[model samples]
Target: MRNVAICGSHVKNFISSPSFVTAIEMDGVPIFCGLIHTEDIKFDRHIPENRFKVLVRKIAFSYNYRDKNLIFTTAIKAALNRFYVVGSEFVGEVIDIGSDVTDFQIGDKVIGNNHYPNSGIEGVPGGLPSNNSSTEYQVFHQIKLIKVPPQIPDEVAATISIGGQTTYSMLRKLSLTEGSNVLVTSANSNTSLFAINALNKHKVNIYATTTSMRFEKELKEMGVKRLIQIEPNSENWVADELAEEIVKEKGSFDCIIDPFFDIHIGKLIPLLASGGRYITCGFYDQYSSLIGKEFQYRGLTTSEIFVTMMLKNIQIIGNCIGKTEDLQNAIQDYASGSLNVVIDSVFSGKQVGEFFERTYNAKDRFGKVVYRYD
Candidate 1:
């Protein structure tokens, strides 16, 4: 059988575990290099189910210590170390299969939904659908292989996999009934726009913020009741009167969809109703560690989100897309024209450095920038 090949580019080398087994040699000698031997992974169906799950655990990462320091200002730099390691999330096709492997065969195109929770940048990683670190062909578990849907384009599917799944998980936490007043921050974003598209069927009153007049106009055309464009440096906009005006006009948002973390928890804490919920899921100039710690320290309105859960009957939730079912549903919605993929721009893999440079530095672009894999 001819082994499939895959490759990707990154700014740094990926480091591998020292104890991983080796089954192949390069230039007549074994070496820990870019290539991994498929023979190293032996699938044993005879093993007990507990042992199988344990083997799965062996393939996963356990980095759960909540150090507030790991969060960085840049996404690519935060992932610099992970670029070398080949794990189950690094998708590889099955060139040959054992008789017991009933689910896979040769020539099958597949991707691994890394089944490890919070292994990627931020706390967004979850099993099987959360991370998209699959930039190359490497050894992957058959259990992790999810066939690409026939109707969906691979690039769009890849783009939606993480963001779509995260939104789906958030929706599970919410009961977005009709007539719910919702204030959606970063309404011009890829995930935020998708969230708004998802909420379109409900009788929810929509209020959104954008920095671009063009995007605000586009969102207003999509049915947002009111769209506010705030300058990034506008200090006058964050004062008490503006918040009060928002409260009076919107009748206090029953739920806020904040993909952008710009509105500090303290800043918007008063805008939520007594039993309301605030959901944040986007990457701001800072990461969750900074926001999480600052909100905990400020004793400001954020205290209600973190502490009032036990005392004030309110809820604050963080959202990220996570679930094959949700992805499947989202695909259907996209096919039927209910959900949309707002691609701001596309960059080739070689141009990804420039892409990340702009994404991290530019403060104006509203849609997602994606790389088309060759």
Candidate 2:
């Protein structure tokens, strides 16, 4: 099997091996580095009655922002003689099943169920099918996978599991009514793009925030009423003329869906109307390099944030990747033409470096960067 992995500062591919190791020297220190690669993962040919093994001959996978932290942490563990397979979203086909497995067949396409907290089945442990999806083979419980309908393409299916589940979960928490004024921060992110597409069906006045307007037309087509541009490294929402004007015209947002609370919460709290809701799924300062380099916004203090939320009755909610039904509903919406995944690019063959660069460092990336293992 062939797989792509993160190596120190480069992306590389290598064939499956019993023991694989790579390291890079920096400042005279040898640092072991690699995350997400194929391995000779062993599985019983006589599978457990409730489990199945997938011979993932082809896979389309993508990265989430959280992978940055995973990459850094996994490298540290790699030095300690620990091995980890890391990837969050992907789609694959099953080629083998347990004798008792009845719901899935050898040729069915599937995505991770990702049911959080509990796997729903009594004995099947689950959070994600595996925290690792980049590998070419995996064993999963029947409850840990969801069959994908034929209408959804591989690229879209690979990217949908995390973004779609989280988006639908956050929207459920917000529970905004029709015609409500809603703000979606980090609007170009995969989760936010999914939110925007899902929100288009809600008949709400959608306001999105981004550092660039490069995708302005596409966002508008996705039903964003206004796109507010902010300084890349600053949290000066009040100083942004377009943001201020929108706030003045709309009074205040009825709900806010933010991807990064550490960056947006202080700047956006004052914009939440009384009894409004503020929900966030994740944050950006996940890796060590970004430590102590938090965004700076003027005038908003911790005391003021508390006061604003208290006085306005704002509901601040935190969410993780959602239930199995959320992923199912998202796929159903996609099949019905009510929702779509926006893919920035797809890579294959030896474009490993370019794929990782576009996924992690592209300033103009507007959607998911996918890798198709051919």
Candidate 3:
């Protein structure tokens, strides 16, 4: 059996292991000898499918920052038992089916997502793929997999599972309409980008926040009227210039889609309209170095923040991955060309670490960063 694993130390090694990936040369194959352990991996031809394997040849898989951080978490280290598969999104075709399986046939393309339990977004506990998409082959339950329309390419279809669903769910939560004044943080993120593009026809007045000007031209093309640039290290995320511009132009945002809730949330409360909505699909500040910091409140420390939130008559909604039906509808949108999934780059097999690293250093990519398998 063949599979790819994102290696990390066992909880037992957490005390002594100084590093995660300690590669040692052996027979020209690097074996992780420290916190992580990598061994020779080979695939099987008797790919027995108890009725569920995506594609005969996995076409592609995209990178999500959560996948990398998940494997590094102390909880994940212990919960995953020994090792962790590194991807939550998978795109491929049905090459095999188990004896009683009747939902699929050979060559039917499909997309699947990893289940996030206990997430703020609240979705059915439909099981996730048994392993991450970093492997050449993965066997997931039939219920979690959604068949993709033939028109959607493998790369674009790959995103419908996670990014698309998350965006769709957040958009619907915002209840956006024509002339809705909205603000989206991390405008270059795949989730944020998809959400913005999906709102194109709604005639919404879009304001975006980012630290980079690299995507300024593109985001403006996407209809973002004003952009707020915030540094990760800056305490004043909503700079004075942006605040003045907002006061001069739009009084308050009717909706704010934020992922950096840990850092910039203090600035958002004052910007929300009387009955505006503040929804977060994720919090990046909480994703600290797993081996470095303990899991605690990395975002908001003051109860006053919540008090202000409530006093403003604002709604604070927490989101994770979307519902199963949301995933299906996202695929339909991608298939019908009602949505677009932008991919930054593609990698090939055996580049697991490379894939994670590229996504980690994504300062210039506008959309998704993906990898393919032959």
Candidate 4:
């Protein structure tokens, strides 16, 4: 079975989790001569205060488990058990079927989600191995599969399971209203572009931000109401010289969606009108804590849209996505052509590591970079 595992060796360099190590300690020793005791202790290379942050990390993982059907690991020693079958979302010629299978047969084209094969839960896995579809012949229960729609392409459909789901979850959290105003940072990103197109049907006004003017024509074609050209040194918290011009025309966004976390969260608050929403799913950089007093003084609220913290009445929400449903919604939108899927370039799968590095660094390019497997 040739399944792709995000091997721990590669994961350590990119992962945020500190390595888990073994150590011994003495607790409340009352003159016990020659007594040695051992207990597991945490040593986070990322921070000095590991325990306090551990609670936050655990809470975040628990939230992801509920929302996205997978876990995000920060532990260097934790095994890389998270994965999905490559062909699950695309229609494939079934090579085999279990004796108990009822809904499917060999040579049938199918589309479905990847799940923990044994436990039968959507994202929760029983103590079973995850590699399934990567094999020459793989088998799964009929109940776990969904029929693939004939209309979508395999490359576009491939991302629906992850990208679409995530975009939907974030949008839902934003609770956009009819005629709402939106500011999408990194407007050329796969999710960002989808979001703009998602709200295009509504009477909402969209202000798309990009680092280059090259996207102006493309974004305009996608029906973006406005485009804000951002320089490499653009600051979100401090008012730019162009801030007045933007606010004057668009009246500031009712909700702000950022995917790359390129826009500083602290700086993003001021870009919103009073009681406007600010939501994001990915933060590529470490963030400074939100200044509540600054928000209070400005009569604005702040939030991080994880599943755990529910923000009501404030209008701003932070959302993270990891689920099959979210993926499906995104996929459906794309298939219908309402959402535009723009790829900057597609590289061979072997170059995926460098692809991500380029994505993370944003060296020189525009649009989403997809890695295709032959």
Candidate 5:
């Protein structure tokens, strides 16, 4: 099976033999990907009597920021000899099923469940279904996959799991009331897009921040009440005209949803209302290459942050992926036409480099970048 993988400097120590190697470059860095032959798994011989497992053939996949960090860091890991297959969100077909599997059929369409915090099953660790989803074939427990409804297109299904799950999970934590003033940072992000769409149903007053107004119309259409455009080079949010505008109009935010806490925490915490809630799922400076590079806090110290939170009775919440029900609810919303996934673009065949560039480096990208296998 041909899979997209990160072949480190010592790849030969990991992959004993690959059928062929294909080199692709992104941001001037070489990514080694290739086709490899593997012995077919005999389901009958491998299936456990008590556990249900399914063999899936990947159809399409998408990148998350986490996946991007994983790829780049794995490429440069000093002692990492294994070639890591890079992808998290994917849509696939169930090619085979174990005898105990009753929830899926041989031809069912599925996406990873990615239940987190708890998998609800004994001894089953909850998280992504596979870190190596770029592989053409993979085996997963039946509980780790969700059936995709016929109404949701393949591209949307491919990218929906992480963003949808995380958004629903974070919003559930916030538990905002109707008409609550909410701020969403990194507004062009997939999670923010999903949050905006879901927040529309909650009837909240949504204010979003972006570095550019390139997708202002689209964001408004998604029900963002106000779009605050900030200068890319601006360091001081206290003096930023756009930031002041939000403060003038909203007074203070009742809740703040941020994708990167490290980038926005110092700038945003001062804007939260007394007793407000701040929720974050991730940070931008994840990999060593980019760590400490985003200095947006303007010298805001940890002591200051704690002081503000303590005086205001503000709550800071950290969220992981989500419960299985979060994904289920997102899927239900999509099926009922109440929610949608925003896809920036799709790539197929051998457009590997283009996929990575569009996924990671495209300033104009406002949604998920997908790669489909033929």
Candidate 6:
């Protein structure tokens, strides 16, 4: 069987330019990378009872910051590492099922876990996906799978499993209501876009930050009135200049939704209103871009953080993936045409290398970038 997988034990060295494993051929046919190493992976024919093979045909998986951090940020110097398939979500059809499986049939369009909960990033290192989802087929547990509504687009269905759930869970915790003021960073992110869509009905005043004005039109459509644009590389960025600008323009935010957790935390904490919540999913930048280093955002002295927290009476919340309930809600909203999933672009299987490249440098992507299988 052909599979495109991450090399856990082997790291590819890019001399002039970085490289990625985007293609693979099954059996004797050189589908992706030239072959002849069947000994590496013993294709097991013995099927597990609760596990099943899903021919997602086209896999729509998002690259998490944590994964890139390990691979690129520190130049792949993670203290503890292992070999396993890499991906967070999978969208496709179940072509085969186990003996005891009754929830799925031979051809059920579905969505499910690509790996153990939050393992694609920081949930746990050991629980990587059994099948790297970039392949044509995957073996996923029945319990982790959900049936996609006929109304949901394949691309939209593909994007939901991770970003959707995260947004749903975060919004529920923030408890936005009319007259509430909220702040979100990386407004163009899939997670933030979904949160903004959900908050649209709440009539909450939304404040968003973007590095580029290209997303200005998109943010406005999501009901964001005030947009904050900052340069992490700028000398004044870490000086809390953006924080002060936020106060003057929007005063204080009731909730701050931040997935890109880095040195900006110190700047953001002061911008929160009394009893406000600061929520985060991961520190994506520290791992992905080795470019201009931002000032110390995290790792503040205990006294410095404690004083800020006490002064504002702010609550710091760490959120990983959302609960099953969150996925269900997101799915329902998508099916009902209430949720809007902005797909940045679609790439073909032949463009696998370019797909990863686009994701690495997401230029002008307002939503999820989908890779559709033919």
Best by TM-score: 5
- Per-residue CA lDDT of candidate 1, range 263-309, in tens? 54545566677788888765454444433333222224544456655
CA lDDT, every prediction? 0.50, 0.77, 0.66, 0.47, 0.82, 0.62
TM-score of each: 0.63, 0.86, 0.79, 0.58, 0.90, 0.77
lDDT ranking of the models: 5, 2, 3, 6, 1, 4
**Candidate with better lDDT, 5 vs 6:** 5
Residue 340 in candidate 3 has what lDDT? 67
Worst 10 residues of 1 by lDDT: 59-68
lDDT digits (tens) for residues 248-345 of candidate 2: 78898899999988788888888899999999998866764533344444546889988999999999899988888888889999999999789999
lDDT, candidate 6, 1-374, per-residue tens: 33334443233322112234433322121222211111222223245533333333434555444444433422233322222334456677766666666677767788764222443333233233333455556665565677888898787777787777788888877777788888888787767887788777678888887777787877897689878787766655533765666667767888889887774575667777888888887665453234444435444466776688889898988877676677788888878877778777777655665555555565765677766665
> How far off is residue 42 in model 5, in Å?
4.0
Q: Given candidate 5, what's the lDDT at residue 245?
A: 69
User: Which residue pairs come into collision in candidate 4?
Assistant: 17-74, 68-322, 111-148, 165-326, 165-327, 237-267, 305-318, 305-319
Model 5 C-alpha lDDT per residue in residues 1-374, reported as the tens digit of each score: 66766666555444545444456665566666554455655556144753488889899999888886777777666344556778899999999888778899989999999899667777777999888888888888888999999999999999999988999999899998999999999899888999998888789999998888899999998899988876545566434666666677779999999998887887789888999999999987766463324344353589999999999999999999998889999999989998977899999776766787788878888899998987
Model 4 CA deviation exceeding 4 Å by range? 1-93, 101-123, 126-146, 231-239, 260-263, 286-313, 322-325, 347-364
Q: What's the C-alpha lDDT at position 90 in model 2? A: 87
| Residue pair clashes in candidate 2 | none
- Please give the TM-score that candidate 4 achieves against the real structure: 0.58
Give the winner by lDDT: 3 or 6: 3
Off by over 4 Å in 1: 1-134, 211-214, 230-245, 260-263, 282-312, 319-321
The list of candidate 6 runs beyond 4 A from truth reads 5-60, 70-85, 113-131, 238-249, 285-301
Clashing pairs in 6: 58-373, 69-287, 263-297
- Winner on lDDT (2 vs 3): 2
